[model samples]
Target: MTWPVVHISRSLDHDVAAVSSVAGNPANLPAWAAGLSSGIRQEDGRWITDSPMGVVEVAFTGPVELGILDHDVTVPDGSVVRNSFRVVANDQGTEAIFTLFRRDGMSEADFQSDADAVRSDLDRLAVLLDKCLLRTR
Candidate 1:
């Protein structure tokens, strides 16, 4: 079965390198990816987080310095969800894009809700990165 894919993106004021560095780090998810987890930690070399559904493991699939933020999330049921996220140059700043998939068995309403969550997370990432840039200046 083919899953519907939606690309949710947010334009950030910081440079592409800066956005990728922060967004690609699993340790920083709690601050921006509110919809994904409340907190995250490394357990036995795996990034773990507690979600509304249950405990999940997150792993970055690519290097951050290259603007690739793709990751795989292992849910409580042992299913691994691949998430595509990338940061690209936009003028003097960056555009962070998250590719969300409408998974099997997910209703239309649930899919829309998930898309909204991704939008919110990207917005939060922009805010967080802006704060970091401000502090460095």
Candidate 2:
């Protein structure tokens, strides 16, 4: 069965390429993605991190481009979550969009909380990008 999807977006005052460069790299996840801020390490070609739930693995399977940042995250329970992230050009800056899918058996409250976390992460990303822009100027 197809699950529900929640989309959260934030506009960053930075170039699309710049945003994509940082967001597309899994190494930068700890800096922007609060959910994975505990830490991320690589083992046997897989990215691993510790979450409140437990140890999880993340794999970024998207092409490196200006607007694509897809990845699969394996939770501690062994459930895989697919995230479709994008960084698109907008006016003089860029807009980052993150797609979250409601997994099976997830309650409405849980889904809402997950969406809020995504929004917070996107906001943090914008702040990081803004700092990068300032440093380059």
Which numbered prediction scores highest in TM-score against the true structure? 1
Model 2, span 83-125: residue lDDT tens = 8988888998888888888988999999999999999899888
Instruction: Give the lDDT of residue 63 in candidate 2.
Output: 73
User: In angstroms, how far off is 107's CA in candidate 2?
Assistant: 0.6
Q: Give Cα-based local distance difference scores for all models.
A: 0.87, 0.85
Shift in Å, residue 38, candidate 2: 0.6
Per-residue lDDT of candidate 1, residues 1-137 (tens digit) = 77899999888888877887788888889999975658999999999998988999999988878899999989999999899999989999888889989988999999999899899888888888878778888
Q: Tell how far residue 66 is off in model 1, in angstroms.
A: 0.8
TM-score of 2: 0.89
Query: Candidate 1 lDDT (Cα, whole model)?
Result: 0.87
